[model samples]
Target: MKSTARIKQVLVLLVGVIAIGSIGYQLIEKWTLFDSLFMTVTAISSVGFEEVHPLSRAGRWFTIALIVTGRGSLVYGIGALTAFWVEGDLVNLWEKRRMERQIAALRDHIVVCGGGETGRHVARELLRTRRPFICIEIDSTKEEAIRKLGEGMLYIIGDATTSDVLHRARVEVAHGLVACMPSDKDNLFALMSAHELNPTMRIVTRAVAHDAGPKLLKAGAGAVVSMATIGALRLASAMVRPNVVDLLDAMLREPGATRVQEVTVGPAVVGQALSELKLQERTGVIVFALREGATQRHVFNPSQERVLQAGDVLMGCADTEQHAALQRIVTEG
Candidate 1:
């Protein structure tokens, strides 16, 4: 808003100076409109151009006043413009508007609450999955750093545990939301607020307290990941299954490498069989498991004869290009 106000102020001052000079020239010197406009431009610009015609004494005094006033306004306007660009306000304003427009146009997208360490990791994973998401962060200072986590990142600086902020993120149309606020309470509140705004939205929340998981789940979170529990489990796995851990970690961190991901079966392909789809032949995507749409049960190493149902999730390993193909097939049929 400050940047926009500065821009408006500069434009208004410049227009005011031009109007005053142009009108004074025409009335005092009895000059043509074109000549008056030219004199006004040259005088304000300090271009050192001669007057269009000889001037009366009154016109001379008017010209002197115009030059003085125009120079001051021009200097002030230039300073404002310089500050707008040099201080990064111009870029910030542009990015904010672009992010807002992109978020508004999105449907079936993800909303990530917070921009802390955990939130940044979630954002990176979402980017890897090629999902459209807008992050809500309370700290405006962290916005630029969070945006550096991925290209085309959209974000808003506002409290995530509030309904107004969630509404601004278009939560009603969002497919899922991840609450990664600093505290379990903040995450729980955000989960409930988002659920209230869109009851059908699938929410995954982060919990730090040992007892907070149950409360978060009860408060409308579809899933709650306790950071301590996961950390302990990960440490155990790394100790016992070092090779397995390294392989999985390498696959996840390597660019353009095959990684585990899930894609929902769109309604258009509800009755299709795995053999009919031939995902490997068409998109080079491998489907190793099918999560039933009705019961949410997992079937590992699904056979070619397995028929897909609406909302059935396919878990597989795919690279970026193959993942894009799978997403298109699932979402666009």
Candidate 2:
């Protein structure tokens, strides 16, 4: 049975025993309510206090029964209470240990610093993509909120700027790190620590101040995002190109809507012409750009005659089903 249920049962049993003892004293000893209650408490507690008045044979027998039943119930109730407390502690300890072991076993996972607004959004997107990630937040409340946001999310409670905390998140084996702490200084510190720990890992950070962007990039962040700048750009875009903004919004809100995506060219596609692949006709995917693997240059509105090469990244737009077909053709071919 549940510990709570057991506790309630024990309490009920004790109360019933006390009521029975008091009523027995009143009837068998012919005493007043106060005297009977006092006698019953004394007997149950085993205090050895003298009785209020001399007891008859029946009253003495009644007292003996109350003492045995009351004492036994009290001991059992106390024991249950103690077990409940110890069991709760043990369960918490076991869960903590299990979580630590799971974190230690993760690799190629994303590490997110802070569980603030930006960090929460980042985590949500990662979760949608079914990516493994660990979030570090100093505030207990935010940590709990993030955990509630997603059951699979992993988190640690500590300052992200600290090396020990970063190490605990296994930054060295992580595929990337997102620094979205509220303060620019904290984000910068965390970015630098993550970069130092894993130079090859991609580090993306949020800059609270516009001027901090350059400093964060110099500090080893691969990308530094400014919410203010993005919001400003978005505002301008809404005014200047309402139709374009509407299209983008529709893509975001509608399930299976076509959106721009990228796919890397594999060995099988090398030396093949765009016309031969006929991606648009075959998969309903429109290719917009080709990023050359060798020169790292982009060829926008690539021609049908253009020859596909290994290591080239194709940028295109397609619906859910078309996107899957395009991915299979690009990677498999």
Candidate 3:
């Protein structure tokens, strides 16, 4: 429990004990309640005040015992108060308030539901892309792991499936979310909640089981990745298609030099042919493929007859400078 909560509990118990003792003293000694309460306070505080009246031997002995017990309670209460102030509970309260402020200021960030290996990798990728993001993990150990990544990231220490936790991550304004929790059911629940919170927000989740993919998609996830299946395919590709693996490895390792880019055709390139764009010569980029809606088709060595469509997504290899050029071509020609 928090120090504040512990202190409150201790004070309540002490107050109950004092109340009961004062009422009992009034009944046993035939004194007024006010006088009995006053005596109890004096005994507890060791105030050295005179007694209400003369006492019998039993009452005199009882007074001594009351002094010792009441003093013990008072000492215990003081110790608890000191602990409340010294154990950094105040710091925690302040940090929580600060976290709320940070959440309120966040917009268009990604919410990572787990801080595990996969979630950490996603966070690293998001960081590389310079995207704002927050992490939510129920496990304290995992949260510590995430904190080691950086100080600017906002984190919520709670279950992701809860709406309040999602709210803490600013789901309303978040552009997307990535859920990599261990349980498929929990991920689905979190995805559903996030989607409900922001209907337009993209939700991506990982599934342990192949069957979970459909359920995750049906539950409102924009993308559902099955790690086990993808890992197996990657292993197979590494064995059978070494060149493809090498190309991906090079792109992944070269942060600014070479990257895999997705360029969308806009009004400027709506009616232009691939040759007219002259991207390969102008930007030194290789057009690897074009994804037209759901279906992706390789457009290697595309001819001059290939006209660019408004919504065509070209996946290609380009350097940082070429990426900038490609963005300009797509947006401004």
Segments in model 3 whose C-alpha atoms lie over 4 Å from true places: 1-102, 254-258, 294-301, 319-325
Please provide, for model 2 over 163-210, each residue's C-alpha lDDT reduced to its tens digit, 9 standing for 90 to 100.
999999999999999999999999988988888899999999998887
Best by TM-score: 2
Q: Better model by TM-score, 1 or 3?
A: 1
Error of 1 at 108 (Å): 1.7
Candidate 1 Cα deviation (angstroms), residue 86? 6.1
lDDT of 3: 0.83
lDDT of 1 by residue, 54-90 (tens): 9899988888888898998999888888887876866
Single out the weakest 10-residue window by summed lDDT for candidate 2: 250-259
Cα lDDT tens digits, model 3, 4-98, are 88788778867976786688677668778888888888878888889877767766777887877778888888988888887777777887788
Q: In what order do the candidates fall by TM-score, top score first? A: 2, 1, 3
The superposed Cα distance between candidate 3 and the true structure at residue 313, in angstroms, equals 0.4
Between prediction 2 and prediction 3, the one with superior lDDT is 2
Poorly placed runs, candidate 1 (over 4 Å) = 1-87, 266-273, 307-311, 327-333
- Model 2 misplaced regions, further than 4 Å: 4-73, 141-143, 232-261, 274-306, 309-311, 315-332
Candidate 1 vs candidate 3, lDDT winner: 1
lDDT of each: 0.88, 0.88, 0.83
